[model samples]
Target: MSYPWQKLGLNADQQADSVLAAMTDGEKFAWLSGPMAIPLHKGEKIPAEAIGSAACYPSIPRLGIPAIQQSDASLGVSALGGVRPGDHATALPSSLALGAAFDPDLAETSGKLLGREAFCKGFNVQLAGGANLIREPRGGRNFEYISEDPLLTGIIAGHNVRGIQSQHVVSTVKHFALNAQETGRVVADSRLNEAALRESDLLAFELAIEIGQPGAVMPGYNLVNGEWASENPFLLSKVLKGDWQYPGWVMSDWGATHSATKAARAGLDVQSGSNLDECAWFDHPLREAVARGEIDGSYIDQMIHRILRSLFACGAIQHPAQRGTPLDYSWHQLMAQREAEQGIVLLKNAQQTLPLPPELSRLVVIGAHADQGVLAGGGSSAVTPQGCLQLEGVDFMGIQTPKVYHPSSPLAAIRRNSLAKKVDFVSGDSIEEALNSAQGCEAVIVFAQEWRSEALDAQGLDLDDHQNLLIEQLAAVHPKVIVVLQTGGAVTLPWLNKVSAVLEAWYPGSGGGEAIAGVLFGRINPAGRLPITFPASEQQLPHPKQVDPSTTTSLPGVKVKGDIFQIDYNVEGADVGYRWFERQQQKPLFPFGFGLSYTQFSYDDLQLCQSSDTVTASLTLTNCGDRSGSEVIQLYIRPTSGRYPSRLAAFRKVFLAPGESQRVSLRLEPRVIAQWETTKQLWHIVAGEYDIFQATDAATPGLCGTLTISAHAFGYRVA
Candidate 1:
């Protein structure tokens, strides 16, 4: 006999409605509960049965609904162990690294590879699209996000979503809204005005959803304004579901759900996450709410409808899990290496210290156990690459704790690259020894690292574990000291002036070592740019005061007692990152979209064309230097109204051969240029002459033109 859902129609909504029509309250309640995380003894495998899942929702056998098998893929297939021993997922470059590349094509490729891996390992839902803006540089999870600019973040995340969903996997665009800081994340109320929300942070989500059309949205643990994100009506129900008209399910971040009725009312569909007790918040509570008439039965039906709709809409139901599919590790590893090579940003190349002299006789690489492997960011997004960790290194946390290193040998890769050069590796454990070894070397390249986790922010931008001292010592001895930094986000460089060259090789993935070697050996030209600003010092930051681990309050009278900490985003408003720096007139050590190429490029022949609906900026780029390289062409819009400093409107990364000239055109989406007017609850495109800045980076505007809008443009919301 055909099920009621199958009999009704083929359309996802109809199928969902039919399924909801036949389901009993008890069965629906069962569907709401989460799949269990199999407890593991120290060093024990996390059971093959739990292989494909990072978080799960129970299946309703009667309705023929399979359990939702989810995977955490912030960077790449996030898993500890899979079907067998040593079977860990492939780890790609951190999201920030991908952002640095500024290539949507690469982002999509990374997403597709990870999605394929997730599917091969039996996961239908991938939580990979993290578009949260880097409002604070020290955020523990900045590595997990794309960029500070909403447009760039959204575009990259959109491609990622498209790539993931192409494999019949549901891509989740996450942390709903305003989860900028991680210090008071779980309990903090992210207080912000609606205008700032729509113009900046929320706008990023809007664009990503508009482009990616993800199958699901995961709400963060923090609060937006006053309400918890999981139960925020304005964000989830009004903006996400109503304005954007998102046809996807909403899942709570692991342990993010607060109240059942509130969450359902606010549009949260699934409560899937870790921590059994926390995940059960929607289970028994929902049943009781429905029985007591506190919550309507329609609300429960809506929740089930959303979940079923996504499964049908995304093809998750049709493409059921396939177990025992062996992954092509070599191909995936190569892709990871390519991503690393493309994303590693060359920050400073003074006197051409990089593209190291071809036939160097002596070269010394120091710090970060580069001989063994490269580092990966910590927390839920962390993926233990196959063979990265040994049993001896596995700790009480079940695997590597605090930090995990991928088994990509940088020393071997460098040695392979420089066959003629004598490469010596130093641990840098002893500053004196490292300094001694650096003496009389042709050049010294220090592989410095700073570990970041989910719940903790960095102490400051300074490199931890005394890496600063090592760099200083090495710089003292050698004229050419190249620092290869592996960090989640921007780090202060006190010794920046002393260093000959610096490469921001953000938590490069499994094949990071090979990518580093290629860049160092001139096999690859660095094209990546800074996604976030590099402040001169911590004092220049919006919040110069360090987070007091013991203190409960951030501001006087703002008590952080109990489970509530208030984080105010009101003062800063929409000025984040470069915008903030611009408004404050504070010069950053390194500006956003800044990257040094071996070959120099020049921008000229600026042009602007505008229609009633859209505006386009076109310019010619010429490679002036001898060597071929790439340049990230950034476009910023400065309204005559002066609501805030110039905002990033558009950007394109262009590659050119020596003396090669090409005209590149970029369209400005009216929505991106418009400012959200909280007073009218609408977007206002001020009627005035606006400056269009064409530049290599945010700080440097080489070409500029003025565009005038004859009449004021207003929209209900960004479309």
Candidate 2:
């Protein structure tokens, strides 16, 4: 049978209008709100035909509307607690890992994998695209987001969304704006000025929507500028729907909706996970408001129209998701491994200590369950793969999120690749035992981990459970020691100088173990760059310590009486990550875009040209070493008039063989150089000369040139 959407010879809007006209008031109300698919409370049962996932909205068979099955997809098709027993899905590396690769094509490929898995598992809506800027490095969910810079985050996230929607799944670019931290997220007010908000967080979403054209947008649980993000007039009514003219529906985060009439009037199209909210505001309450004439019936029709329009536009209505579809797990695993291999950043390799010699006689692998598997970030996005190690972890919204590890043994992978006569493993539980095991070995490789998750922020950047002390002690005894970090975000490396080499492997996914082995054995060269800045210490940040709410309780999913707080984002304004460091005149432990490769690369023949309002930079990048590798070409711009700090205007990753050279030309994103003028409600580019630099990273500009731009104002909406 042909689908209703396909049967109609009209466009998405007209089809949605036809569907809305045929629906009764009860059916219209049903589409506005829905409960979480998984039962949260003690006695609640999942609705019939609903898979236990993030959320589920019932279908109207009479109208041929398919049910919306939503799943949490931060890194993959997250099977929450294996809600379906014996269920497993391919897990990709953290979003930060994808960000490090600086490959939009890879991002889109990863997105397609996520979308395919979700669709096969009967999920039509995947909460996949996380575009929030990493303003707080210690944020528990930083692993879930892309990067700190707006340009990088937007382009990467945009491609990822495009990939998901391409698979006929509705992808959402989420947490709408300024949701930078998990601490006090439910009650915290993210305060920032309009101009700064436009330049940073909003800019990321704007670009992603322009490029990806995602079918849905999810607002954060927090408040933006003194109003809940789900119902904020400026954010929803003015910016997202008005200025940008986004055609998609706005869905509230779980437990985020607080009103009925206000939310509908302000542009919230749906209430997701309605059971988590104090009440199902979009149901009876909305109906009551409509009957009382507080909200016009036309507004409800508009809401239904938007939802159905997205369903038609994204092919969710035409190609409904199905259960038990066949998937190539092996091929998917290879794709995951490929991403991990490209995203592993070699932070330090003193005296060329990496690419472990094949002739090495002895080696000891220690710590972080190297014998068992590689670590993964925790929370709702956790995917329980086959043989995954589940450790007790945080509890949120009546769900236990265990710290999960994919069954990819680094020890086994290393042994398979190494020619060493003897390879040993130590759990690193006892420092004395580890030291004894490593005593006479040729080298010691310690896998250090700092697990971060949702519902809470990390206490600090230090390695927990005395791992630092262990590394410090091991460095004291061993002459050649290597440290492989499996962390969610940046950490303070106290024993930096003590280790012979250090690898920043940020929560490598399913094939992480093999990818790590490939890099260590020189089968794959490391090219991943730092997406977020690693601060020297907490003292260098905009706020030395993260702001704590006045409430006594810190646990998420629990409401404290009179609980409310404010995060003053105005302190640093839109200057995030490396930009903050440049503004403060403080050097980071490692700068953004900083990464080392086995081979050397150099930039030369810098050239610049301007056409209309756009500035284009052309440069020659050559591999100076005798090894094949990839280099991320970073282009930065700074206004000669000192309007703003240097921003990452454009970037590209290119693979070149030994002694190979490539000439690349990149056009700067207009918003990176243009300032947001609130009074004019548009982007204003001042006519001036700007300094352009072809940089190795944010802090290291290798080649310099100048470009003159013509002054002009453009509409804020991305076309």
Per lDDT, the best of the predicted structures is 2
Q: 338-393 in candidate 2: lDDT tens per residue?
A: 99999999999999999898868999999999999999988877888988888998
Q: Give RMSD to native, each candidate.
A: 2.9, 2.6
- Assess every candidate by TM-score: 0.94, 0.97
Off by over 4 Å in 2: 1-4, 550-562, 717-719
Worst 10 residues of 1 by lDDT: 390-399
Off by over 4 Å in 1: 1-9, 40-52, 60-64, 81-84, 274-279, 390-402, 547-549, 552-562, 712-719
Model 1, C-alpha of 349: deviation from truth (Å): 0.7
